[model samples]
Target: MAPEQGTGSRSGCGGKGRGRGKHLPGACWDTLWGDHSPPHFPSGQVVKLELLEQVQAQLRDVLDKAMEEAAQSYLQPHRKDPPTQHPSPPHSSGLLEVEHFRTFYHIFIAMLCVFILSTVAVDVINQGSLDLDFDLFIFAFGCLPTVLATWLVMFLYTLLVPYKALQLWAGSYHTVRFPRLFTAILLEALLACHAAVLGYYPIYTVIQHQLPAASRFIVILKQVSFLMKSHSFLLEAVPGIIHAKPPDGEMKLPALSTYLYFLFSPATDQLPSPRTPYVRWKYVAQNFAKFLGCLFYSYFILECLCIPVFTNMSKQPFSIKTLVLSIFNATLPGTFLLLLSFFAFLQCWLNAFAEMLRFADRTFYKDWWNSTSFATYYRTWNVVVHDWLCYYVYQDLFWLFRGRSRVAAMLSVFIMSAIVHEYVITLCFGFFYPVNCSPSLPSSEVSAGIQVCLYCQEWYAQIHCPLEQKTFWGLVTPRSWSCRS
Candidate 1:
């Protein structure tokens, strides 16, 4: 009976081994699909692939989380994964509202209207022969004072009042209702339209008659004239005259003023040839060089006349050569003459600072201290323009924002002065727009770029927060799209 039992156990163990061996490690799927499996099928292998894929997916998720954590460690709090673009609150002092600008526009328009209407009335009442002119020097005389008084208030308010209104509008808890602001905007628009109509009607006839080309030329000429009259300081007589106003009855005249008044006055002084100043070799040399420059320019202009080929070409149909010669002939002598005139005028007008001029132009040929080269020359040679720029631009900036930051104030003032300087030049010489001189000339991208850069520099300096180098770069660097466009 024991032998029979042992045989049965051995047989049972052997039978179990055979069954286990027949079942492949990955054959669970095969068992389920065995009845459905067709010839040449590998159901067991397919099950193995499916199990491998599941394991890979789980491992991939774990690796991805690790990589994400590594990336998060290097990123700023606001620049994780999707990146945050949190909008900063508008600066308290930066922007003026639409309504505030409108109010200023209206007030200025009203003041302008009053001036125009009054001027027109005076003219018509005197049968069109009546004329009104403004002089900056004689501010106290004539109707000038009345006009200036009103205009001064208007101008000052335009600068200061709008900023105050903007401050109020931007306030959080203390905000009053802005119905007045809305009302002001509407009133300004109406005033602007009316003013436009009034001014346009009077000048319409002449403006209508002018062809676009002729008008452009006229504008350019006017702009050039304006530059010469307004910006250039070589002609110191104009500046001196601008600065020299007769002392008021109530004010005491300074000693220098009294002497200048006497010297320039029509009255004859009882003669005393007490002191004859020593002659300056430097002055003599400058005058001689200036004379030579004039001679060369005069001869060059006449030489253009002598060139019959160029003269004949002007009458012929336009070609590149004809255009070139015409422009060259016009510009070269003109530029030379302008330089010559600048030099000549310096001597004739700057008699007060003769020694300084001599030293700057001749003795010290160093560019930094010299006054005969470029814009720097104007500032150094003729201090009047420098003083004006300082008084208007620099001083005003200091007065407004000096407490905030000295460097910022200086930069703002400098940029403002530069823009005003450029603007005055453009207005006087109308070279900004196409056909401002030549229809063939493409628009002045270079000049426009200069203007934009200057403006941006000023704007950045005015509003940049402390330590915001990013903001500074953003303002200065042109975007890719901006360049392409």
Candidate 2:
């Protein structure tokens, strides 16, 4: 971006130059324009005509970019929930299917075994017999009946309300008497209703039933998931259906089966075309096993870290120093629990569910562990939620502003994510603590500011959405996790 050396040398029109004590503006002007005093022309010559033309060209470029984004966001005939950072269809593969990194899969399994054995060893040394107690686990997963009923109620509302409203509105949108006005009113009404219901329903149910930790997680997680999925469906479907130019007069509605599938499918985003059915029974079984292994691994990890510490704590009085030391001690186990959560939910559970569906995409997550920058981590980590945020929230808002101020869009994404995270914790723990949201909101904005330029618009041109092989930072887990801890 530096100017030419000749231009720079000629253009130092100031009281002081680099070596020369002073330079006159006339000298620099003449050097740049090749005239001591340029001859004036009519107002319409350069000032009016050329400036107008340049302004028009710039406006046209902005307009064209805006239209392109609108078409992608609103006019795509398909593409309900495509993966993140992919313009066209993305190249997706299983986590363990990478060429040179199969060892990671084995390493996870070995870690699982190690944790299990260590848990057994500790029990034997203490009780003189290998015995595993799951009172805490049972407590965590208690109240399953109420959890299931609550999920069903929320699911039914999401399944029917948004889809039906969108379907009816789209069918009559073109033929309506006042299309834009009516559509605006309808949208606001639906959104308000949705907000009122989904906003308070999960918290109400959790408080009413006093559900346990894991049980409450299911409810809160589903609430967030369904809210996102419903928004995505409406965002994607409404524009495409309304904009369709069919030879026949009547408009087509999305199939109920497809909509139902989207509700149950592992991927939150919609795709342009459906994936072919693959009955990978063995793969499903293996992933379920891994999911269970992650749970047991987490349990043992908690026990290994907590049992001795709690025993010691019971023998001593609580104090500021003790609390600080306890936090420091929990750091490593907290890290293990977080990683195990990722493995359990994103890698194992999503993959298993997708495979069980017989026709679902398996790119639930990516090599997020290898991400060097927070921006890449945001895109690669937990791609299911990230895809919904990127597509329905970030891209929607980004394009709404005509691709200007991506920082706003990125911040909106993190804010939405933080709200859901805080909401889940508040409802699950029966306390409204913004601990998760407090640091993350500011950190995400700061990260967004620093990382605004790291992402490119044409990132989808690559085959696999790969990151630069970072030697050091790639190995570091996200600092945001530690802040929450």
Candidate 3:
């Protein structure tokens, strides 16, 4: 009886093994349930398995945290902190700080006072009484009414046309079969009309009438700037509207307040909702005072440093000697002009308007002076415009090219920027002279390298050489030239 039972158990075990082998390899089946020593995991294997589980859990936690952080960062591109009155402590401040400019502020104030005293003294010395020449400054802003009127027309077109066009396009885009094509055509037509009325006509009037330098500057700069701003608004906003899932029924336009804020904001990129700070009249007053001070500083530099040197050079015969001398003489005023223009526009003027309108983002510029490279300088110089070009122009090109042609994308941005700069210079000066042609040239990389080298040389010369030596070498000698040919 015992033998019979054992045979039956053996048969049952064999039958189960056969069935397992049909599904899995014999080695795999044996590994799962073969005859062997009692199953025992090594201590090392137990520790390793435990460690791997812990590692997986840790990885999951890290990934979750990273995703949350990424989402938060994506939602808030701009800093949300409100503006503060106090300058950050030096030790705590980041690489760039407004507090760093305190010493320079004192120096500029002293310099301005000295200029005022010198102007009075010079007038007394020359004419036996104080007789200030504010005519030049007055002349610079002579076409205020014309500028305002022209700006009004530009504002109306930009405010009304683009927003409405976008709304119409967005409403019809999904329902209509050939919506994109039709929308594109309509947009092009609107842009063409804008270009003709605001861009071309203003440029024509400036050139044909042979407007004064200052008047032409106001007209052309504003025209070009407004056109760029309007184009940016449409370019940024329309694509978003088109791509977005439509709400239940009716199409909606962005708030009028948002559009109005965009027009006046220092930033070129249009925001659906912008930060609005509390308007402080005192801050506004202070900013305006600084703006006027900057204007005076510019006028002083032009009158004292630039006028005498350039006027004297103009009278001299055109020779290597004169040209070299002029280049050297221009260095101080050129550097000063660069600094003044940056401060006046990026800080004082922008801040004044921002304060008046209670606009929160006051970072119109960065610490461009500290930049060691031309690329860095260009990026940091005017952040408002840089943001627009980077997002709208450069990034768009990169996207169009599927991220493969980075060099080509960068070159396109450079060319576009150079063209705009050249346009401003040529149209403002009423000449076809391409002042920024080198940077805009086909071989722009070589041109950029040359500029960088020239900049480095000038920087080294300024630092290593004493003021007296620099003046003697740069201002007096015919051979010691610094200007790019």
Candidate 4:
């Protein structure tokens, strides 16, 4: 054969036999494989066509077999691309709106914050920042101002403003009184300062190394009951009773001696009955005993329900501080209850009796108790101190001009009340926030100053502070005397 024909014959694969794909025309075959089996150049040249053809045929057969095996293995009847799972709807972030937060979650969040803050406080204290001695000093002086400031802010925000708004909204009064807002805040600070008085015993104990375990009830009771002076229950009940003649004859004043004896007696008959404040000595004694019995039973019930858990789990020291704090925690739920009793029951009864006396005499507001308006009420409601205002202040001003002027009396009363209130509050506040820093600063002066300033610094560190310690201590102790109480 001719050299090119020989190359073509050697390179022929199955003699260009038919297959599934398109046919290779004679002209194309001669150009692609006849003379150039291994894809030779356009320039004529002989090449190894047969060996190339054989390799190409083998490769084709192997590829075909491999592809068939791959299809059989991968292409099963149930197989699918992982269903292109649309990503799960993005999870909600739990963000709440301001109104929703206020309506549903503010109190919960506040309680949680209180819990967290309390834990942080306990940690700081147990960690012993500034050591024990310095801790007391900070409690007495340094922490005072911050406590006062916080109290002032809280009172203003929680009490006075809300009260005034409520009163205005109620429409019982014709006008809104907005004098001495600053003085109100000052009073709250002063009230908060009184809490420091509790620190005295605790500080003394810490100094004497007498800080007892919180498990010791005896120590705790002595400290907490410091304010519960021995009194004739009859005596306390008598003043209000003697001072309060019930409107109805059926409601006779309770027996004085029985009430007094009950104050000291361990028997159930010592406490006054809500149902019968007017009973004579015999019935009053029996009822008082019942009241005491009930109280004791209730106390035991509560103890059974709570004390075991508290005593067993508590890790606090039973210092004076702890006792006071425990009392505070215990009493907090009932704070408004006591306030209501004082105002609604006690004040109302006393005022009603005063009115009855006036009615018997056929005189109106002339009785020492009645006042025409809010301004007048302030003067008459606290008469003993008001007498000083009338005599020392209002009277003096009137005498200076030789007459009784209602305007002068009003101004004098308002100003005096404001100043006295301001003075007490400012003194407490000054202790909470120091004004002048110098070697000349004295303790009495510092105490006196805080008693008067009535403002506290915001950035003051709660760590190594007295008031902060007391607040934490209050949570674990027996009795906490707070502002409103």
Best by TM-score: 3
Q: Write the per-residue lDDT of candidate 1 for residues 1-485, one digit (tens) a residue.
A: 22124453243224322222222222432443465643343667556645654664567578878888888886846533432432222221111124774574466446445545665686788776655442311221234333334334333433343333333332311233664575467447534643443223213422443323223233333332222222222122223322433343222212333333322321122121122123344644655664554444434333333233333432344345544445544453344334334444443223223332221222111122233334454355434345545554566567787467767766675566556554433333222211222222111233223332223222223232223354656544422112211
Worst 10 residues of 2 by lDDT: 453-462
**Pairs clashing within candidate 2:** 80-270, 81-269, 81-270
Superposed model 1: Cα runs more than 4 Å off: 1-335, 352-383, 403-485
TM-score of every model versus the real structure? 0.26, 0.66, 0.69, 0.21
Model 2's number of clashes is 3
lDDT of 4 by residue, 46-88 (tens): 2334445456567767887998889998887763433433221
Ranking by lDDT: 2, 3, 1, 4
Candidate 2: segments with Cα more than 4 A from true spot = 1-93, 98-108, 121-130, 244-248, 310-324, 432-485
lDDT of 2 by residue, 98-149 (tens): 7555686677678778878887787899899988668779988999888888
- In order of TM-score, best first, we have 3, 2, 1, 4
Candidate 1, pairs of clashing residues: 223-428, 223-429, 224-428, 224-429
lDDT of 4: 0.35
